[model samples]
Target: MNAIQALTYANIAIWLGIGAYCFFLAKKQSEMDRRLNSLILQSKTENDA
Candidate 1:
């Protein structure tokens, strides 16, 4: 392959890797938000009781 093609492939691979990492982080953040909301609800219930 030519140098230009190799560079293009490398750039695409880097972008794909970054996209996958961002997806993973988003999933983790969603889970954390869910857990935090659950905890807040529990705290409010306890306070009300």
Candidate 2:
């Protein structure tokens, strides 16, 4: 492939990698939020008792 074609492919690959990384981070954040909410609920329940 020519230099321009190679650069295009490289750019596309980099964007895809970045998108995948962002998706992974978002999933992890949501999972952490769920766990934190659960802990908060448990604490509130314990306090009420």
Q: Where is the poorest 10-residue window by lDDT in model 1?
A: 1-10
**What is candidate 2's local distance difference test score?**
1.00
How well does candidate 1 match the true structure in TM-score terms?
0.81
What C-alpha lDDT do the candidate models reach, one value each?
1.00, 1.00
Instruction: Tell me the TM-score of each prediction against the true structure.
Output: 0.81, 0.81
Q: Model 1 off-target regions past 4 Å?
A: none
Clashing residue pairs for model 1: none
> What local lDDT score does residue 26 receive in model 2, on the 0 to 100 scale?
100
lDDT of 1 at 8: 100
Candidate 1 residue-wise lDDT, 1-49, digit = tens: 9999999999999999999999999999999999999999999999999
